[model samples]
Target chain A: MPVMDKLKAVSGTAAIVGVAESDQIGRTPDKGPLELHAEAGRNALADAGIDKSEVDGVFTAGYSTYDVAEYLGITPHFTDSTSVGGSSFVIHIAHAIAAIQAGYCEVALITHGQTGRSDRARAGGNPGLPSAQYEVPYGIIGPPVAYSLAANRYMHQYGEDRTREAMANIAVSTRKWANMNEKAFFYDTPMSFDEYHDSRWISWPFHLPDCCLVTDAGAAIVITSAERAKSTRKGAVSILGAAEGHDHGILHQMPDLTRTWGRHSGPQALEMAGVTHDDLDLAMIYDSFTYTVLATLESLGFCGPGDGPDFVADQRTAPGGDFPLNTSGGGLSYTHPGMYGIFTVVEAVRQLRGETGQRQLDDCKLAMAHGTGGLLSSTGTVILGRD
Target chain B: MADGYNKPIPIPQPESDNYWEGTKAGELRLRHCDDCNQAYFYPRNICPECGNNNTSWIVASGNAKIHTFAIVHRPPHPGFMDDIPYVPAIVELEEGPKMATQIVNVEADPSKISIDMAVKVVFESITDEISLPKFEPA
Candidate 1:
């Protein structure tokens, strides 16, 4: 029983003392993917008031961990390059904590960046691998088509006005947050439900507004022992708990697209933290698509299988709403540079640390960051707390 | 968009040769696990369900229902420029394996496609070594 208690008490094992992003997010056409990683890493280390040499654990999904190490000139004793798509960095946080607890490394750095818009370095969709022989020939290539299949099915089983229209609420609500964020790509541009439905279709059931923005940006977070983090100049957010799991590598191969691994990972993550949904102050769910958020939210038990539409209706996730979701505008209106997962961590850390200027949640104590990767194929949830 | 249809062709791997050959012969086949009797797609020597190497192949009914579908206005690549506004779908074969395919012989409008709509497979020979199994209204 004592051993079980010890294992469960991972809340304060490690703390994120620093969170930073590359400068000039929306249109950094000059910088490449690696340059963005280097800048974000350097800036994050500076935020922690720590030196690059202090980083012994490196975690990244944007580029090879070895390349990240070389670019930052920090040779990490432990490295992770798990590329489950956008959710890799959030899932990597769980692994970073485990490695830190196990004494593999002290300070872990998780970084992500890409020139998804300007340079055509789009992330997530891996082409010409194994699935290519089967899926590619029929044009099951990218997320737009791959994920739209599931959305269309959900609309069919339920109803389009309920399911698909509910998805539009996410886009509109996300834009509402973007309007408040000076850094958001759509900061000046507001979205309306009518405009959302009228937008050109990339794939049926998913309009232009429903798709995530492709920008050039990078975000990173630095974590170390909770005790060590207390000495840093920045406020440290405790790593309460985190869990990661996957349903399928390829979207079509997923046995059930209606739900993701979030069903398992979300509960397991909250249980590890000894927290409940009621304890959460904010949620930063990956919004690669409106359906991505809905599918994950339902599976996380926030709503029933067919309840996503009503749950998000009336702009519940928008500003001045009960559920403060995607306070960073999410991928919908925020800068989604390939893998958007790391940015969610950055925003959650800021919200918990009370650093968010305008979109700050009052008396924020606990924040949830859920990352969905590979077209609802993989899910990772990390519960951060201000202890 | 290019004048020539330059869509990339699939080079058959050793394990998937049988499936490709079956498509060329105008027949749809899938691997069935002798241990678990689970039918799976994308032609592999080993059964994905039971991990049985001693799997047998069976000719599929080639009949499936539209599990889900999407009308892609933008092609993943420029090679598919000619095939814009196409409906790509995940169809569940009668044998229980889900295969990624395209729904053809239907109106171009997105509203025309519906889930669980009965469809059957048709072979399209892209090249000498490659043949694709497409689906259309039954």
Candidate 2:
């Protein structure tokens, strides 16, 4: 059988049955991360018309004091607390597929929440492993700095004169998409390419407008087999293909700072799903930084590596353009609660289901959702469709 | 002794002891797996490729080429504010492992740093307990 045929055999085998969120998310002084997660989880289950008792698995990313089984008041047959930075949610989807295919669990709930806006100013050392102590002391901190290194290198490798202007175009295009998304944090804040160029530099190549928002919010989704999804309250979004690849953990370990696992993983996912770039109607790429989205587009065969700047030029990524990207404003304009990967899956499913309201595409039958973790350490790509 | 300053230090573990010890001796050491013959840094007990536990610490030549880097104009943390517009780089070491280290002794001008500039290792003592390994133009 051909790859597409093989993929079609597994098509509709697993589906995301429901999705939900806890209110309009942002600087939520009234709530904590756990409360948002729990509320979103409850809402997802309610949307699926299923009770917590039926959930056999719970998957989450990052630190959490509330045990998945304990919070839901049921002992799950399987549990995964895999945290791979912002891309954890995308990885969670692949994990859910494995669990269902292995007969380990039937229904899995994946959720994310954070109080990033209020927590931004608070500074203390991250309490995990001290292996990075040597580098941390010299001031290599956070994703922005790490990604900035890659962005700077790309500019140097490929001429620098118009690079910032090219990047500004990308930010402007995303903002245009956000204007249609009422849920986005910067819905009313439309930005121009010139405005993006004039924005103060956060890290040389990366301007203030190029970075993603640090907003407080929570989102959850329910995944189960196609057989079970048929009985759910919401329509199903099929899992076409999913793949994850890791090159290195630390920024320095990357073979080439300008390139990432997305270059390798994105193509593999498309090949695995038996789909080509031409078949994709829309894309929800993880935009922790504008470079990430640009890199993914190039890696996924949308354009060549250095050609990303040209590919997204002239409002190409905006709605009514050749390729519609991040119709939900992406993390750049949307709420990013640290793990913004989950929202990519959520948004992709929404688009595939034609639930994006004004931001919805006219014919979004097939969609691609890409997520990155660590400092471009790991990448996960999932292709979703409605067949 | 001052606000927003804590003496940063590395706490060594079984997998990374040699790397820390190598720094004290002014040598950069990486772990080479006997099974796969692939050298790696950020010391792992087992080879990431072949999953072999038999590994040995080997001193590197400290020679490298700039693979990619970023010049940070903004400091995300208070500790880094003074070092704005500094270059944070990823260098491909001659020893066959890629390492993340600061590139020093080079003009901050973007025109100067190319994609594959040759570089060598230098050590900077940050605290009494730790000495960081950084790269400079070779």
Best by TM-score: 1
For every prediction, compared with the true complex, DockQ reads 0.69, 0.53
lDDT of 2 by residue, A222-290 (tens): 999988888888767888787777887777666766677787667766776788989999888889888
lDDT tens digits, residues A241-276, model 1?
A: 788888787767887878888998888888888989
lDDT for model 2, please. 0.79
Local accuracy of candidate 2 as per-residue lDDT tens digits, B1-138: 234455355566666777877887899998899888878866777788887798887889999998777778877666676767788777889977777778899886677887689999998766555568899999
Tens-digit lDDT string for candidate 1 (B26-46): 989888888887888777888
Best by DockQ: 1
The CAPRI class of candidate 2 is medium
List the pairs of residues colliding in candidate 1.
none
What DockQ does candidate 2 have relative to the true complex? 0.53
- Once fitted onto the true fold, the runs of candidate 2 whose alpha carbons sit more than 4 angstroms away are A1-8, A63-66, A121-134, A161-163, B1-7, B30-40, B44-61, B94-96
